[model samples]
Target: MRMSEKRAKMVMSQFKFLFFVLNTTGLYVSHESRDASLGFMVQRIRQMKFVGSVALLAFGHRLTASGFTTSPHLSPCSQIQRQFGHSITNPTRFEASVTQRSLSTKPLEFPENPSPFSTIKNGILTLHHRLRNEEVLQWRALAFSFFSSLFLFRHAIDVKLASLWTFLTTSSSLIPRIFRTDSYEWVLAVSAFFFYIHFFWYADVSVRKASEQGKVHPWRKYRLQDRFEADKHRRSVELKLRRNGEIPSQNELVKNYSEVTKQTGWNWKAWTCEVWVYVVPLLTWDILSPRRHRRLAAFGAPTTIQVLRDITCGLLLYDILFFTGHILMHKIPLIYRTIHAKHHQEPEVRAGDVVRLSMVEEVLEVGFSIIALNLLGAHPISRSIYNLIITFLLTELHCGFDFPWTPQNVVPFGLATGSRRHHFHHRNGKHYYQKFFFHVDRLFGFFQKDDGSLHGDSVKPNPHIPPAWQ
Candidate 1:
């Protein structure tokens, strides 16, 4: 066979493949579905015809370049190209002809009246553009407020749903007593966990709001005084070192103790191990102790006043226990290094970091609170609400923001210890061991004021101590 015949066969094969692809994929059907307008369909047809003509002319040129002689019985496409003065003999002339033809062919023009569908589409696009412009003009304040409101509303709905679920699971005898115990405990546990996750989201918004405000409110400003003072003192020391022609060592420059030995990367294995170790034992205990579990599982609809009283008691009990544990964890270096120090790993804390703690430490921190509240004869609803409050406060403490509009500032003398205060504790573990109650630290002479005063008196500086006890 001639080389020209082989080249022509190859070109025909390529053309056949292209046609198959277009047909099998339903490309034309998709285009038709995209626009029902007659004008659009006509324009699409014209575009396809132009593309087909270009392809045929190019194929003819390839055949001529391979020294194929033109037969008298020429194909319809070759004849059409010859008629249009696009001969394959001169490649440049053929390209010029094709370009001129393409340029001269004007786009199809539709009637003055557009189709109803097209009109509706255009109207919708205009409305969307107008809304976007309006949103930009208003600085998105309305949109932000709307989203914030929606988030809070959704959280409220979730809380109600959780409460209903808890009530139903605890009250009903649909499941046997053996299974009921696990169900009741898990339902409450899962609900509390869900709320904990939700609080993290809320704290993110709170932090952003605080950043916008640019400063903490005067009411909670006292809580952060010590942190500010420490920062100023550190900077002054650094300046003195620079003046003395000595660069500060890494150890000297360390503001937060956690930063010194902080983990550089996440340990997924440790997290998974801790979760299993923590949850398994708790679940096992609940399953084994039928009497204790049944008593704890008892749910009742308490009065508003009763619920408020339970919350107050729960908060007080938690503060007392947490204060003791926190101080011991610091004083007895073993506990601080092994267990409590897990939470202090993040010097610059975030809202979601609330749950980032040692399994043993978490059990002691949260388990004690729950047990104490249950023993105090608090209703299930009250316990749930208390859990929610504690979760919110903990997340807020780590959220790294002190907005004026926060409940800590809005509610006069609210129990919230403020994020800055807790942040200082993470920075310098030697002071500020208390969580919710500031007075506890003051009473113990652990509270260091912004002016470098300990328990209302000037104190001499102490040397850095190792995290582990001797």
Candidate 2:
């Protein structure tokens, strides 16, 4: 039963006892059979309590209803029966006035009809009530961003903007001939990986240190802070072992040491591993790939309009193609062993894992993204620009921070798959294989969490499910 009903029953019992005392004192009943008479009166009150909604009136109570008056003796009062019933207020706080009329019975007296505050509040409430549709708000954000992008693109193309063009032209003259072609994009892509990953390493490690000292994060609410995830996991596991009084095996000790080594913002050994692994394949692709020849021949200084359009298309194409390749790499056991499994080596996807793929995997990513742009007849400058954008995206997707203003959160319609999703893939190795957009993941129903929640803009509440290493 509801709490209010329980409370009402308790109050009713008290009233029954009170009436029995009055009967014992010979105030309402004088006959020797007063107990029997009191029992019947109490039974009638209980019946009315459960069966109907009506005001309760007993001896000497002021009731203003028609054909009801105060009774002086124990008798069958016909007028005490129910007339047109009205709802009774539930007992709250055991207030004495609960069964009696309120002292304040006057209507609200106002001096004005269209009061300034009342008009303003009603107008605001009407708007809030009308805008309760989630789909409408999503569409509104998307529409506003689309029109704003179009205006900027058109303005950039129409205006020459000599200062910006001069700066670029002057810089190109100083650059080497190799970079004048498509090598600049390769350099740009690599540079973006380094800059972003390094920053996250600092942000994450600083926050962790602050927490150890029982200090508030200096500026945590402004920016996303998770960066050194491998170290974070190591610390968490080490803390559990000490707190639970467990003995550690030799293998567990070594694993914790390895995580400690990764705590550095800069790891020369791992950095060396990634660079050589990427460069060997990169040199081979540049020297021999058939697509490079085609890209060099069609290369030009693309207009601002063309560059922006290709960047947009490249992001979409990359998402779909990457989604397919990523899914296949996980589903096919042989492929996972030979290629993609290397990227999953870390307990958590962190700053360093941005380029942690094996040679073949790296080559495929560079190939699909650059070659796809070439197929669209994008100029080398446009391709170079797109490379820079996608590099930042790839780094941040696994950077392990889901800050509100990040590109993942900025995108409308729950599309971008931020660091949180990739973190989930590390834990389960079963779902959320896509990198950027939710389109492919949604179609396959792989967008749901392990517990089966659909993807949304919010971070999945528990990103750190137990690791396989544990």
User: 1-470, model 1: which lDDT tens digit per residue?
Assistant: 34556667676667556544533333333333434465554444434444655786776666665567446577534654665433224323422333344443433334445658999999989877875764332434454576567456765655665666465555655543433454454455545655654554454444334535653323222223333444455566678899999999866754442111111233333335554665677777766765544554565434555666888788878888888888788888888899888888866555555667787787787677876786788875576677677766776776555544444444333334556567667766667665665667677776556564332221211222222200
lDDT of 2 by residue, 135-235 (tens): 34454566568767766776665355334344444455655344544345676777777787788778767656665665535433322223234335545
Model 2 TM-score relative to the real fold: 0.55
TM-score of each model, paired residue for residue: 0.45, 0.55
lDDT of 1: 0.55
C-alpha lDDT (0 to 100) for residue 152 of candidate 1 = 60
